[model samples]
Target: MGRHRVAIVVLSGTFVLDLAVAAQAFGRRPSVFAKIRHEPETPYDIVLCGPTAAPTSLGFTIGDLSPVEWIADADTVVVPGLEEPWAPQDPTLLSAVAKAAEAGARLVSLCAGVFVLGQAGVLDGRRVTTHWALADEFRAAFPRAHLMEDEMYVDDGQILSSGGMLAAADLCLYVLRQDHGQAYANDVSRVLISPPHRAGGQAQYAKATTRPLSGSLSPVMHWLIENIAEPLTLQQVAARANMSPRTLERRFRTETGDSVAGWIARRRVERARELLENSNLTVTQVAYAAGFGSTQSLRRHFVSRIGVSPRDYRDTFRSTPEQSRTVGRPQQGPAGTPACDAGPDARRPGPFSFMH
Candidate 1:
């Protein structure tokens, strides 16, 4: 495929991290890193630009950022979030974005960048999302938009929008998956060391309170991952962390942005996804492997969380010979039946009960 041109439009007051996420995901030097025998080449030709080449609010300036109107040739145009999204935007910048969309460029918004797209009239009558904290404001500002509050990202074919700051990476990864397929997307994700995929349906806010975790809980978290299939309880988890169950719950919530049970379920589903894609295991076998206990339970959670059934997901993302090396850290178990490392898909657990 020919290299697709990507123009990332940086507005004044831009959150620097938003721009970097898209750049890193799309600007990956795959040739230097991917040892996979038949890996696909990187597909994007990325450019950074702004309305007038002004420095951002954070004081970092991109000397090479072109003018916003240069986006005319772009196949994809990204708008990064701004600190003061409600402030007046430049008419020229908004017009350029609207023009690009009218010419059929795929439009994307990161976090609060949805405001720019909204002003361009690009999001009218389209399903979209932004940071959860600003969902109400976004709804009020763009009444025509079909705003979904809990989504990680929404892909409405020609337009895509992501929730919050970090989800821009997820959106960029989605672009890769759409362009290059899941294995290639996963390959880029591993390079970035970010979570490979978060289904658009995932809640924007985790169940935990807003506070960040205080101390290191890696030891307990690692142990829990290693022993996911065991029939562990709150007491056991607390004991492993050397804390009382109540304290453990508080700390775990703070540390991971999720409750212990919620985290385990998400991990189990990720394991199921891996097995479905990489292994020829039956859906029933995969259920047991991922600690879902029964195929019925697997189907319920898999569909609810992933927006697809196990069978459908496997069929869509199943590893082919060319894709084998890119999916995960391949390993050999026993007589070399193709075991995976502790990558997302290979962390299958035995029968275990959820501690409510």
Candidate 2:
């Protein structure tokens, strides 16, 4: 298959880190993957498209970028955040972005880059996210858009957006996973030293409190992680922390922005995912190992959190026999096709609303 074409739109005052994130993820193929047998080469053809001699927010100039017109031929168009997102954008750039959207290219924005999508009129009525600090400004500027302020990212079919800075990596990896599969994305993550997937619904890193996890709650969290395999009840957890269930519930919501049951369920789902990817256990065995009482229970929670069945997830991520035979390390096998479409409706509820 031909490589996917990715065009990054560079504008004046572009945040260098944001640009670097997309460039690193798609522009450059990791040399480490080349030595591994049967690994798919990088499947992206990346171009930085903007006016010549564009000055960045870091006071440096990026010269000899491809022309903005090149975005019209891209399969995916990425817009990185600008240091001054509220500043007026170049009309030619906005027009090219609008045209790309009209041509059905996937639209992506990192951080304040959503503002550019908003200006291009492609974000109206679509779900999107941006830096939490810019949420109010985004809403004020584009009231028609459904702004998910708490989300680390939002995948609204053709338009995908992420929160500030590092969330760019999250969205880029997500797009990679969508285009390729879990195993391929995982290998890339290993090379980058980043998690393969952080749920888009996961909360953005906003300071909700001065003490996110109080001195009292820190130990409880560690304890829970250690005992994640056990089917511990909220009462049991609260008792372990020497607090009433009611107090513990309130504290959990305040400190973690999640209910006790919700947090535990997320942890269990993560455990199930790990086992599914790395172990040869059957579905039932994985369910029991991950603290679910039954395969039925595992399927319920897995589908709700991961948007696919446990069996399907394992099938997509499990290493092949050829991959398993490699000495000293597991090779990422062939890319798995995404089990579902990229539309938001195909995903389960956000992490905040997981079954409790």
Candidate 3:
């Protein structure tokens, strides 16, 4: 596999630690995985930059950062949190990201770096996350981008945004898991002693249960979350909530800012994602349980919200927990594990290429 270059933008007041979370996960090679593959490991090159080729932040001046061109050739670009937004990123840094995205390079930002991605226009029309305290302002600032409160991170395919420094690590581990299989990803997790997965779309932290119920319609939302896989329509949920469809729709938007259909669909997708990542259910089984009624429907929503299909989700996680093997290293046995793995999946494809 050819080495994939990474470019991490560093500016004045940039949080040094946030830089390392990705820097450490991808920047340093662990002795553990060295034995797993014989090919000389692909190197991860990190180029730290500021307004100029030389970064002035980081508590001292440093030089020789190559140019922001590093971002154009980089397979991935990571933007860590800046200290209080003191440095808005050299205009070139933001422009480079735009150029990279146009070229298909994946863009990742942690914490307030969402602001940089926002400025670069990479997050347009995408759902992204940031520290909860800043979510309100972030939304107002970037009206085009949907802001999800309290999510640990958000992986919207080519553009991934994370919650904070810790969430930065989650993003890096996800990259590891994607680039190397679960085995190598797990080994890196063991080496770092961090959990293997924290899905990008999960709230940075669960919002406090302080939201008050209005109009006695909350039970419907609860039921929807629990029965996500069933075929549900506005009339059905309206009937369950004992309200007119218009009233229910208004209430749903008022309480969740999600239309009735959008609300139910998101819950169903999240349910299926939770199970797919944490359970071993087949695409078809998980579909039925999550209320999609069929695997195709489930895959439709799965890709819409999570960016990958159900089978890909299960294949990526089968060797881990949340399956039939809990109380052991594996949470449980997988339902649709890749055929080559031989744990399950009667006709799954050979494992998807990791180095691609």
Per-candidate TM-score against the hidden true structure: 0.57, 0.58, 0.55
Query: Runs in model 3 with CA error above 4 Å?
Result: 30-43, 52-63, 199-356
**Candidates 1 and 3, the one with greater lDDT:** 1
Against the correct fold, how does model 2 do in TM-score? Answer: 0.58
lDDT of candidate 1 over 214-254, digit per residue (tens): 45888787787687655567888888888998998888888
Q: 1 or 2: which has the higher TM-score? A: 2
Candidate 3 lDDT tens digits, 205-316: 3332344545566777678776665566777777888889899888778877888878667767767767766765656667668766655566667776665667666665
* TM-score between model 3 and native: 0.55
Top-down lDDT ranking = 2, 1, 3
Model 2 lDDT per residue over 1-356, tens place: 68889999898899999999898888767677665425645678899999897899999999989999889878999999998887877788888899999999999999999999999889889999999888879999999999988777889999999988888989999998898887777777877788977643433134332234455688998888788767677788989989999999999998889999988888888888888778866566677687775677778787776667777676666765734565654333235422221112222223212233
Off by over 4 Å in 2: 36-40, 199-204, 209-356
* RMSD vs true structure, all candidates: 11.9, 12.2, 11.1
Best prediction by lDDT: 2
